[model samples]
Target: MIHPLNFDSLLFGYPVGKINVDQSWDEQGFLEEAKTFQLVYIFSQSELKYSSETVRLVDIKATFFKRLDQSADGCSSLERPNGELDQRLVKLAFESGAYSRFKVDERLDNEEFEKLYRLWIQKAWENREILSLPEKEGMVTVSIDGDSGKIGLLAVHPDSRGKGWGKKLVKAAEMQAKREGAQGLYIPTQLDNLPACHLYQSTGYTLSQKEYIYHYWRN
Candidate 1:
């Protein structure tokens, strides 16, 4: 069932309504506002990931479809890595030794890989609006399951816990998936992750199935 949220007014009709951005954001207020709109912004980074540019999270923002109708422009509010604002941050991540752990190809020699990577990043930014947080960051990739819809991996940093960040991330993913006509969203976690299990259940998701794995170690 769709969660309850507040509605300002219906412009076109039901399922094509607007959110009252000026409305207050108390827990109850947000819940009431959320019921009216199919899409809701859970949490945003406020600051552009790469720049000091600031946008008020509470500002009246239109749905992607509505905005597209008005502008018919390819340019997006999304901050892709190519733009001047994002390039700096991308450079920093590459220079810092952090990308090494992920084994990201530092050598940007492959034009095809770069193109695919940019598209992947754009899709991910499009999927998750809250890219500012260091903890519970997620990446989107094509599914090996050979599906049309994308698969997401939300990884929570070891230091971050008890904050419900991962749950918020999953909610974002579900919204994106629904928007993209996905059957459902799936996440895989180890059996030992009790906290993760609770988080998933709290957000109205259940364990659909489990996988068994055998690891062979060499001494």
Candidate 2:
């Protein structure tokens, strides 16, 4: 069945919908239904065979998780942003989403991709949940729900890639999560994004889940 995505439709200024299908789904019928929306997101546990019109946006979505049994290091160096959002932070946010499906789908305008990340950072900052490491090298946004915590966005500037800022920001997020009484933290990234996957793996996070994501754009 197809479900309309209200927020996504509003954000992109067009009709958007999503379909969660299993291996037994009807491909021809799915395509017919997909054509009703401007954009349709297809999610599946295993890959699905589709016509050329459907684009495989993410081959694998890898999610990592780390328990918060022990206190995390590198918290001292992280600072919460005050007042206006830093332009550098906005740049970092945009860089963090370079591998996102929004950027990968050529159908979406480049300006919309930038606007999406920009507003993401702005909302995180306004909520005062953003943590920035020293010198604006990297930043992470952490949020808590019940006993779980999530890393909303984590980014390290391209110029500071090799300096271990990404790991530090991750540690800072963990520390923040522990302080908020969360039992564990979850971070999700595209499997094709090797650098992010490596960073999370090297920082004590283990692979928790994997799924396939596809996009069907109405012509």
Candidate 3:
């Protein structure tokens, strides 16, 4: 028999009839992690607003149209539990630049790292598709200026839409950069992503500059 409270486990594809029980500590940690990422995602945009109607836990299976076991997941294995790859990627950005800039050596603890991972899973469980680089296909971060840096390949899961997490994430990144003494952070995305534009604007990030990114190659 499944406990009603355990229905959320079904969000992750736990069998319908089985009760999903977890340690209190695990639950607490997961919530904290989710809150942190949620905060980051919520804060990233100048225009993206937090709305309960937009951000809600959804059926992962319904959106994927497959068993939870079948989806192809991509994430940064830089942390244990290893799914909230976005956080890791952002952390990597800070590490690559912050280390060079501040000369500070810091890493997230196992618990903190795991918590971050759980946040990713929660977003997925809510139906968002995390678009990261192909596995083992090295990703890159570039310094934008003396006071800024940028990361490519950032995305929210497909199923988790309408929550304004995108803007939140941008805001959080900006805050993180400022705390680390960065004047700002920069990102480039297609102009068609109106939602993204609204998000960036709502969160105090602006369209400071744009340029043509031409990819010419001889094959």
Clashing residue pairs in all predictions, respectively, total: 8, 0, 29
- Where is model 2 more than 4 Å wrong at Cα? none
**How high is the lDDT of residue 10 in model 2?**
86
> Which tens-of-lDDT digit does each residue in 1-219 have in candidate 1?
223333311321233122222223244444454454533333321221211111122221111110011111211221212323244223222222222211232222334233433444454444443232421132222222222233333444444546555655555455544545554556554445556566667766666554322111111
State the C-alpha lDDT per candidate.
0.35, 0.85, 0.33
Give the lDDT of residue 44 in candidate 3: 13
Give me the displacement of residue 211 in model 1, in angstroms: 1.8
Compared with the true structure, model 3 gives a TM-score of: 0.33
Give one digit per residue, the lDDT tens place, for model 3 in 184-209. 46666444445555655665556754
Q: Ranking by TM-score, best first?
A: 2, 1, 3
Clash count, candidate 1: 8
**Candidate number that wins on TM-score, 1 or 3:** 1
Global Cα RMSD, each model = 23.0, 1.5, 21.0
Error of 2 at 16 (Å): 0.5
- Model 2 C-alpha lDDT per residue in residues 130-186, reported as the tens digit of each score: 999778888999999999999988988788789878887888888888888889999
The clash number for model 3 is 29
Sort order, lDDT high to low: 2, 1, 3
